[model samples]
Target: ELEHFEMHAEEPSYWPIIAYPKAWSPSAKGTGEVIYLQIYGEEDLEQYKGKLKGKFVLIDTIRNVSPPFEAKASRHDVESLFEMATAGQPTPRPRRRNRAGGFNLNKAIWTMLEEEKPIAVLDRSYKGDLGTVFVSGARTAEGRARDSAKVVIPQATLSVEHFNRIHRMTLKGETVKLSMDLKSSYTNEDGMEHNIIAEIPGTDLKDEVVMFGAHIDSWHTGTGATDNGAGSSVMMEVARILLKTIEETGIQPRRTLRLALWTGEEQGLYGSRNYVGDFFADFGDSGYTPQEMKPENENVSAYYNLDNGTGKIRGVYLQGNDAVRPIFREWLDPFEDMGAQTLTLRNTGGTDHLPFDGVGIPGFQFIQDPMAYFSRTHHSNMDNWDHLSGEDLSQAATIIASFVWNTSQRDEKLPRKKSQEEELEEKREAKKASKAFKAVDPAGSWSYEVEIPGMQVTGDMVIAKNGDKFDLTLTSDYAPDEKEVIEGVQIVDNAMKFDYQSEAQGMLIDIKMNLDFSEKSIEGMMTAGTFGSFPVKGKRNSM
Candidate 1:
């Protein structure tokens, strides 16, 4: 079974303790009941809370061996085993550098809890060819599990040779002695962390809000210089540049602008989500309107994200929402000449933006060049200051600052598309049918057809079962009654083009045109993704 890792919105930074699962071994007394083991909980919750620790207790914390200079067998170096098998050489095979082989430690802890069994766990450190030993996030592992266990989240780092010695000795029915001491105390200050928040209030619309930020915390084993320290500083630089722009340009934005340096973002989206939602009670479900769900109306005036280290942002991810592609393209235009002007229509939704996207907000994440994100850095021990590049960091900050500047100065509240009422209604109906609630689609699940002089309008649109069909039909009134490939915007009038974008057979999402015609240009400046029904005067005519 695959291991499951659950993520939550609010997580703590500097947790000092982590409870990760280490292994599964023979049930105690060799009962063969299949036992699961892990480390969990504060060092002494009983001492702090003054209770029986709610049926759970833990002792010890991550014990670091020498600074990971060397260690034992590694599973990833399978070539050694292969060479041994093929060449018939008495070779030293790499150790299986794993957390007790691929067991769902979280699920095991939960199962034992239901069975009312008390348990103790041992989290060990592994040495590898990487030459660095780092403590695991075992406390975090335990917190994520939603289970109770007498978890002893302690570790003793050993050389690959030392670890193999233990394993090999055990395989030979020899016992190895391991004495451990892990201790700690809890106080209100135990979980307190920091968030770096900065703001530029709008002159005209100080009440409305627009903001951006990245996490400030990072793994302590290293300087956290890259894991997030770089992200935080770049965001900070964005704040500085925004302030400089406002100070020099004196163009007070009409909306409040804020920069948030998040804590625990390494664990989850804690800070940003809270800010957007703090005023939740003051508002209702500000949901997407039908227009918002259309192909070209995903609303998000602007949001910039950069997490691929300090690498220069080669492009912006479209997040599968093409509506904003042209806008981003224009924004990148100035920088493209500087080698940063690419806009990819690809979706990226893994980091902090996830929390915002979950709440129906139009969230965006950037695509940066993969400069050693995996070969080095990331969550590994090598994630430190020396791995950073000044040129990349500077470019990222410049772009982020520019993005925020434009968004803050935009004319109206950012464009937002409404989710389709029809789709929502259909979902409700499906739920009703499954529960036998006597709900059905009276429209009979098909489209209605109407013929125009030049084209045939497929009926009330229908969603395909396999999600692959959208084509416009041509009628004989203007041409032969044959399906014409839906050439985009065939009929252009008054700077406007209306076409039935057939995204599937018998399904059509209509395009009622109204694009941003930048004041001094024609055609290319058109923000077709910015949907509305307004007309613009152009060289062709006025719509």
Candidate 2:
């Protein structure tokens, strides 16, 4: 008989803990002195060098958090749904700030903490004000995991109320103590991780595959429910539904329906990238460019992925492939009532589908509603089964299953846009066109005048070209003592940019000029350092 261990407390009593070496256990129990390590910089650790050993350390300050009274879970509202269907812009990602200083400081702090050997590290939960303790992986001293080297530590999180109490008690000169017994075990003896793959094989096109996948691995906190557990569940249910359909309807797909549950996605799309590299294309040394494409690259029809959260499918991101717009529109027609009608040319990144897309495969991620994935559940301790919407998951599974079925049963493989090589060539040609300006007239001299705040300066410029590179020499009344010449300039379209220095009022001033050429006139801006920029216009001097 299986035994169940349950906690019967009003507040959350069974808080989660992360420890190193997974097999290690702390059996000691009793109240001991707790130390709050408010070390943000590397030098701060020197003050508490010997104080952290044998004492629980509070690493973060207690923050004030409130219960989420607002609706944290919701499907797409009508207005938002309409906007999603019609909007042409991609979901704007938040700009990332440079964290090199913070990262180095943290690295130093962890290293010093490991050397100091604290009894345990405690942090306040980021969310869950009342009793929710969102937890994640413990920090290794060297900052990352290594095969042979594991900097083990016992780490835990406390609710905001409990953590604040301890923090306040310490601030008031009252001694705070804690008792902890943390045990964990590590296993990966074979040094292998696998992605779960199952398929409904096709009779005529058994070799060609249409893949639908979601990342299975997630943060240790909160059972990874909304972060990816919802996606995993939906993809699994899709597999089951497809199997039943095949069994009942007696219609096997023309192309194979392969379900892939990927791992290490949160760790930078490792599983899917490895899969693509192994079978489809070689990512090579750069990790972005495809160097060698394997034979299996042509065998894939498309890869569909879902990982945005527990939101139902609203539409699809076409990843800039306009050729498939009409085709997807036709497919989405039947599911208009289910709200899966949008098809945008924008690209959505940061998931497992990118690897396939990188190799020119028709890979896509569905458009989904926000649904508190960003504000609450994603990567937080609050990410659990309760946050998942059953209706949304069922709808997602149904839509994705139909998409997979349609792709598999299509008479031809899904249409692909230009390959990476062709796209790169087009970009190179456009760049060439942008850099090579048309010679409007044969090499000649043009007279121009610059209008400044206090002065109008006249200048004559001689233009010459050698192959595609252009050169210019200017003599202006503002700086008649010095001649400014620029060489080896490439004109983008009809515009050319060059830098020159002139002696003005006993000061050597640096100036940047942009020249635009037409059949009858030459116009430009002369930007002198600190003095300001002035408009310069010229006409071709008649010989």
Candidate 3:
């Protein structure tokens, strides 16, 4: 029974505000003149739809946050843990710029600011500076559910020096006012969300297990302490030091240690992928793609995870198995004096041990000490708890409680490597020679030729279909006055991605193909943005 909220903004002495109500806003209580929508289409929403119904808007554009002159936190020295233990095989980071058309144009400008009835809706605080107010959520435009949002409007964020002093005092004609009350609510319970389990039982492998977890849901601005309450307080202090070392040496665990804690893990790894598809392995929704397995997936044996934050442990990420590098280098040789020696065979994707390494198990994560967790507490609002670090969370709960007491007193179980149908049939024969160019029979038209060493490349493509979408056109003499049409064409598993853009000499280019079909040809690879990747082939034009 612990859920509550309260907000009451009305301070007007000429500056010093902070706001952040928005979780389902609507308890409104107004005061106007803080408007600032700057420019949101349809002729600026019809010249600011009758000056925004009562106004306090200021939707965005004031981001100038600063003042972290380095050293927000530190650790991992020793030449950055010997360059993350001899780096190599890590590349794959660049792809986070598809803000789905600026998040559907900020949900169509928050549904035209609730049909132009704004009296609250400020923003600014993409990261604190000055008065620190990095809050989150509130702007429904069909993202509903905060108890099913009917028509929310009251939003808030402020603090980037009070949103650049009320946006430079409304671009110098100054009027500012702003009042605000902003209440919030939503918790009719039974939305059932739990995952705090805990255990130890295991003399003679009490039904074999060994788990360990972290994400205890966070991100209401600060107090998510290092984006995860420092990995849920170091996995609840390694389950209270394994229940005080099994009550001072009366010994116990031979398998079942458990621990869990997770809860929607920042909404993606949804509570450990629904507790690994409700008890170890299913991948039904094609999530981490497994398919099926359960029987508690062969009774588990390894899971270990610890989100990266208060930075300590420094060695693990064996996600590409490699036979668990000599069983995690004999559990990091007793924590090489607490710096926990390195190991990496790469593959460290975002948390919750990727649904138990996407189902084949033997999951892991460790490798900490990146202090400043991506510079100043992830999901910043300075993830408070004074940026935790009790000696790096007691050296990550004493090296994850001795790697969960050596995988619950191992006697065999932790070595799994390939077998999710042989790693999806070795990723379908390393992508079956790019399938051939997937689909393209919307009545026919295709032909290609290439030589590129100074040109001799010809092309033609047409593939149409409207009722269920798929359109492409591509006549080329290498940019013959660029006409490039390539809308949402997909095919999956036979392959055929899409993306296009062109211009040349004045620069714009940006291609990206990927075909692969067959019955009469079509090959792949195109890329082209930074000007690289070519090899394309085609033929099939006799309808």
Q: Which candidate is the best by TM-score?
A: 2
Model 2 compared with the native: what TM-score?
0.69
TM-score to native of every candidate shown: 0.51, 0.69, 0.32
Candidate 3 weakest lDDT stretch, 10 residues: 90-99
Per-residue lDDT for 1-543 in model 3, tens only?
Answer: 113333333333444466555444666776766777776444556667767877788867777655677765576678866765675432111111222223345556667778887777777655556555556556566644254436777676766777787788778876668666555555644566787888878888779898898888887656788778788888888989988998999888888888998886764566887888888777665454557788988899889888777878888877656787888798889778877888865556557886787677888888787766665567656778887879988888888888898888879878887633354345445766564424445436888764332134677887776545566677777644334666556554555667655543222345666666566776655544422334467888854
lDDT per residue for candidate 1 within 63-142, as digits (tens), equals 33445343321122234223322331100011111212112343343334434433223333432223343433433233
- Best-fitting candidate, scored by lDDT: 2
Instruction: Quantify all predictions' global Cα lDDT against the true fold.
Output: 0.42, 0.70, 0.68
Residue 449 local lDDT, model 3: 61
Q: After superposition, how far is residue 402 of candidate 1 from its true place, in Å?
A: 0.5
How well does model 2 score by local distance difference test? 0.70
Q: Residue 238's C-alpha lDDT in candidate 3?
A: 92
lDDT of 2 by residue, 334-449 (tens): 99898788886656666888888878799998989778786677766678898888998999999999889999988899988775335434544564577553446425788998
Q: Is candidate 1 or candidate 3 better by lDDT?
A: 3
